[model samples]
Target chain A: MEDALLQAFLFAQETAEEDEGSLIDVVPGLMVWTFVTFLIVFWVLRRFAFGRIQGLIDQRRDRIREALDEADKARSEARELRDRIAQERQQAKMEREQILEDSRRQAQRQLEQGRERADADLRERLEKNREELDAENARLREQIRRDVVELTLLASEKVTGKVLDEDDQRRLIEETIEEVDVKRLASEN
Target chain B: MSPLLAAAESDFDPQHEFLLEEWIPLHLGPLDLSVNKAVVYIWLGGIATILLGIWLMRFGLSLRPDRRQTTGEAVYDLVQSQIAESSIPTKALHIWFPYVASLFLFIWVLNIIGFVPLPISNDTFDLFGVELPTLGIYAATANLSVTLALALITFFATHVEGIRYNGPTRYFKSWIPEGAPKPLLGLIVPLEVISQFMRLISLSVRLFANMLAGHMLILVMLGLIFIFSAWWLVPFSIGFGTVIYLFEVGIVVTIQAFVFALLSGIYIGGAIEPEH
Candidate 1:
């Protein structure tokens, strides 16, 4: 760089060999050089540098846009899923309550049926026991009449000294029981 | 005062720094294509701009960027987004983005080169029996001719693009306001023509004046110390000179380059799609 500068400066003494024009003076040579130099720089930069940099910038911008779009889509999908789950949970909750209500109603119906059946069974048993007791009382009454007839026969034999045959004894016992009103006597005993 | 300073004092003209000293004289009939200091600086600026752009923009660019690539992208973004995209239409961006970008960078490089003290000088001193060049500050952009040439390119390009986009009749016709009183057409037409030429003057002179003024201010400040030749003037002169120097390098150089490029874009764009 220093060498280049030195070479650019290699010339005469401090004095301008010719007088310079005013500060605003136009020089054709410098103008041409400026124009040409600018053109060269512009062309080189356009060809070699700008195209690729712009393309890369556009590429990065596109990637960012795509990423943002994907994020938005994912967010919406998550919201939808949450909504569906909430709806299903609500339906399940209603179904559960309905099942509990049905179970409770069925339990109440079964309990009523069981209590009614138990009451009917007790009534039937009580009627059966009362009939059995009446039958036993009738049977005891017959057995008492037989015992009284035998006792009457034995007393008659001991007091009068009569030895009655089978027909007479039967007749005598019959009459004696009739005269004694055995049904009433048995009732009294 | 030093002998070199004494020598400079004799030849001290603030405008001399902007003067082109013909080093290798080459004439094409009447046209002087001589290699001069301004020409050399322009060449240097153009070449450096190309190299710097390539290095920053092309060499190390990755999806995951390093510092060099990041800076390149930042510069590229600034030109593309701020200048080219804003001024040039979408249809024309492919053609003009690089153009405006190059213009900005080239002018900016030239402007900055003016402030930096380089070994390229119109004068030299003897060193070890050899005449060696001394360091001096010169900016090619400080010249009216250089800025005017740049403006001329833009001026021509604007009309060409305008004509090409909207046939010559339509493009030129758009310059005249619609439904103007036929009587006033005579006055308006000349004024419009003058205004079109004025764009060239304004564009060129704006950059030239700003760059030249910045340099002259710094030079004048330092020159005060030399003019008075007082020891006490050293602090004030150096202090003020340093301030102006910093101001020029920091703000003026960059803003001038930006304004020139921006105006070029606006003119070209307006030509293509007439605002009125």
Candidate 2:
């Protein structure tokens, strides 16, 4: 095993020989060019690429935030306005209903008062007409009594050339019933 | 295909003669530097770092942060608060932000390249063979060359920042605090300065060593299945490789990235600190 290991090492070293270049051969030129390229690349990247890209992304973010804030504010304001309008509409509706109710109540009271007045006027007129009818009936009864007396006087004169039948007349009047005008008085009162 | 015949036909039969000799030519004259696979990877890592850095800065910052922004900001903030602000005095830290940030990002990207499976082809003629295509890009941090270069940059940047902040005389004098024993300055200041320079070595070697060891460990572990001809060793080696690979995926990547950033911040912060 040891011999084999040594053999392998020898072969590896020999392979290194077969590979022509040493790391030493190429280092100086690599360094010079590496520095030059680094500077150029650094300058170009700084100037042309990264600066603007970062700035743009930041700007976009700012704008987006601003827009979002504005939208939120606008939405809140709209909601407030809507709420106010709703409240106002409710108030107006209530006021209108109150007014209508008040008018209706007033109209009902007026109608009740007018009905009472008309009923009172009709009752007074009816009482006055009843009193006039009673008065007229009384007057008509008196006239009829006078006409009956005249007829009795004419018959007594034809039977006996004088009016001397007083006893008979007294007897006749006592037998006749008195006419009571209570209904006619009631109408007059 | 009978089992006996198959066994006889195996390439590793004792009778078969396999040449064990292989030669790679190395001519070290005038430091011949070529853009090899590691170099390509280094470039890729560096480019990726810069692009990612720019993306983090540009796309990560927000007036109002989201998840990605928060994540990016958290990274920067973590580096800033823990490293720069804590290590360096607040007054001096701000000036080093760019340098520290750059260093942090550079190191992080280089360290992260280990996970990338780089294809290595034997093309001596391509890079050195003059006829074949070059070996392709792999993990650059796996090579000490790249990490050393990075550390050198950090070293120079730290000095530059120190000078820039305090102007040379005050900066050097700052090493000797006001009430230090007169003899101690002579001894301590030199040591402090040397140690400061030595920080670059530590930083470079730390990253280079870690990356190199981790890659080598993975390679060696995976290579074991081929090394041992016995079937029993296969499962063990594969299991070991898998565990290390998984750990590297998480711990190695995160630790390397954090350390790189932390060290960069510390370097810059130390440079600019006042004489407190």
Instruction: Tell me the lDDT of candidate 2.
Output: 0.60
**Where does candidate 1 chain B have its weakest 10-residue lDDT segment?**
B2-11
lDDT of each: 0.81, 0.60
Runs of candidate 2 with Cα error greater than 4 angstroms are: A1-27, A41-189, B1-33, B54-70, B88-95, B120-137, B177-180, B184-186
For candidate 2 chain A, the 10 contiguous residues with the lowest summed lDDT are A173-182
Q: What are the per-residue Cα lDDT tens digits for candidate 2 across B226-270?
A: 455445666887898778777766787667756765786677666
Per-residue lDDT tens digits of candidate 1, residues A18-128? 345524667787788888899999888888888767777788788888889989999899999899999989988988988988888888888888888887888788888
Best candidate, lDDT: 1
lDDT of 2 by residue, A5-60 (tens): 34433443443455443432334554565556556654554454434554655586
Please list the residue runs of candidate 1 whose C-alpha ends up more than 4 Å from where it truly belongs after superposition: A1-18, A106-189, B1-8, B126-130
